[model samples]
Target: METKIQTGPVSTKAQMQTVPKKKFKVKSLLGYAAFVGPALLFFLVIQILPFLMGLYYSFTSWNGVSSAVEWVGLENYLKIFTNDPAFFNSFIFTTKFMFAAVIISNVIGFAFALMLNAALKTKNVLRTVFFLPNVIGGLLLGFIWQFIFVKGFASLGNMTGLEFFKMPWLGDETTAFWGIVIVFAWQTSGYMMVIYIAALQGVDTSLLEAAKMDGASAWTLLTKIIVPLILPAFTICLFLTISMAFKIFDLNISLTGGGPFNSTQSVAINIYQEAFQNNRYGLGTAKSILFFVVVAIFTTVQVMMTKKREVEA
Candidate 1:
């Protein structure tokens, strides 16, 4: 029985390979720790701490600057739901803005993405031009639009005789609502477009080819095939639009400053006014918590509902 004795060279090579494998496992574990530890620590410090503090402060009657936090239980929350008319008004305005912004922004964004995705000579440059507005700070964008609505539009109206441009865009209730919508759409459409474009690009070419072979019209292809396939992107865009619209503050401040009568104030602006401006810290904290809950609930319900539709489609 010639037992083939493994050579020392072979044993040495095997040991060398094993040594690298062991080192790799240890190194990978260390790398994971290095990456995850800092992130977890930051989340604890920045996010968790503030969240806990906010929750604690919601039960207190302490003004934001006060050292004495007198716990008043559910009084703050009760006041908002029971005694607060302004809160309700802000809610109404926020809901309306959210509906309008989500519809217009997603529609325009999806439209632009569709057109740009269709090969055109100036598509890249066009995308850059369209997306440039989104990169500007919200406050700056709001101020620029303010000038356009206030000064530029007046000049244009004077020159071109367009009455609509001369209307009180930032001063009146109806016009202010639309003004916010217009600014929001302009600022956000590019972002939504980028998402839609990526989703559109990911769609299977073969599916489109089959649809074409079946003599599906362009409209039908878009309606039945393309739209259904990009439902995930729709979910994301809808979430972004809804959250951004509800929490709109910079544009509201810069453009209207809750103007003409707090008619254009979103929930965030209203909360700010209540807490800091009015010194109702407890009530404001309560409102903030409620706002968080409302957004979370609405977003969750919307995502689940749309995800179901996506599956059905």
Candidate 2:
């Protein structure tokens, strides 16, 4: 009885602790709302909404400005596969462009990265100069190259009497493709170089020293030590190059407008023509959706393959 009487008031400490927990949960919810709310809203409104709308319109016939949209089921897709020669041509063109751009860009970029990594004078300035083209807008760069290809280089050809520069870089199918590849490589290599430079810097100096102590040549150090260690960078660079090559649009447009005879047309340009020029919006949407799937699949496979190699390395 005496011990029971000692407990005069019940402890409310446990209840008080739980009150702060409720407040903390509310505070956490509010914080999340403050941080992520705006971004989520914008993403939904801009990207997700358009994507869903595109999907809907792909199954319908609308002239892009019409009040009425008629459902055509799978007609647009079927027509794209069976009847659209332009779509196939664009696909073939895009593949060719991708192959050339990826190879040249990566090769040149890796080479530059290696050179810059060496103890050389003016490496930083060289990096900045190489990266300047990447900072310039793609459309602007395209136009600049167009001028060089037509007006500037033509003038140089006249003065030097060089047959190579005399050929129509943007007019001929063979030369036009190479022109695109060359410009793209020039523009993007700097960015890739930065990545490779970082990777090269991360390499263990001790391992390099050990290789050198073992009398390994420069080529052997690059092949066995440098290359193997920087495999992750290779994976990233390849992924970026592949994606950029596949989705190229502004450069292709400004350089040739898929012309001379649509010989250099890319899938993006083809979609633009179908949607705007021909008023086949549904068909264009269908093609775009297919293009998106192809790119997604290709990028996914490439990343997986490259990542596996990185692990093996």
Candidate 3:
């Protein structure tokens, strides 16, 4: 007891040695901040801030032109739910259009991809021709197609004496809906075709050759092998078309202008009319919020489903 006892357990030799800590590199941190800070700042200022503001505005009775913003709470949302048949109609039209456009566009794109995947000498030229429509601005494309549907088709109809081109492509409700779908598929398919072409090129040729050795038919090879391999491209093209079709504004506006008794009005057009034309900013924002939720759900479900397929494949 007289001998001095250690106050605590013996320390390890390594512990006795001073372990150097990582130096805080202000230079590295500054470098990271320098690169990412501007984009983060702009995103906050442009997108996030506007969205938060819109959320608050959706709860108020603020006519955009007026400085007097009355806080109306859920009145705008309640009006949309109880009194808005036009909004529902517009949503219905948009949903229908989305389905039709997605199907036709993907089909045509895949077909174009298959065509160009072959060793045709003119494939490169055709690819450019196909993708050119996608380069044309949507508003201009819509206008050009509008002229074709209204006038050029009529002239062709007269020349050919066929009822197909004679009917008012953008006049009647049924035709107007299909007219939009047609133009959308034509413009969009080319872009999707390029994606498919890229995906197709990446496919393993050995697998195809092996299938050929196994006496696999073209259809069988495509359905059983190639399609699964390229499912990601399908996912991408479908997502793009679905979003584009749902938010169709410039094209719908310039082409039909929601004509044929507003029968062809899309949800985007409805929201635009509510906000700008009707001067109901609060109600319009409410509709937009609702639209955002629905579209988000649909696209999320689609992506999840396709992702599962990719995993399985």
TM-score per candidate: 0.89, 0.91, 0.92
Candidate order by lDDT, highest to lowest?
A: 3, 1, 2
For model 3, residues 1-313, the per-residue Cα lDDT tens digits are 4998674555554454534222346666788799999999999999999989999999998888999999999999999999999999999999999999999999999999999999999999999999999999989999999999989999999999999999989999999999999999999999999999999999999999999999999999999999999999989988898999999998899999998999999999999999998898988999999999999999999999998999999
Residue 16, model 3: lDDT of 47
Q: Please report, in order, the local distance difference test score of every candidate based on alpha carbons.
A: 0.93, 0.92, 0.93
In the range 1-313, model 1's lDDT, one tens digit per residue, is 7888879999999999999999999999999889998999999999999988998889989788878889999999889889999899999999999999999999999999999999899999999988999999999999999999999989999999999888988889999999999999999999999999999999998999998999999999999999999999999999999899888999999999987788888888999988899998888989999999999988999899999999898
Off by over 4 Å in 3: 1-21, 24-28
Ranking by TM-score: 3, 2, 1
**Each candidate's root-mean-square deviation in Å?**
4.7, 2.9, 3.0
- Model 2 clash count equals 0
lDDT of 1 at 125: 95
lDDT of 2 by residue, 1-313 (tens): 3555433344476677789999999999999999999999999999999999999999999889888999999999999889999899999999989988998999999999999988988999999998889999999999999999999989999999999889999989999999999999999999999999999999999999998999999999989989989999998998899999999999999999999799999999999989999998988999999998999998899899988888888
Q: What is the overall TM-score of model 3 with all chains considered together?
A: 0.92
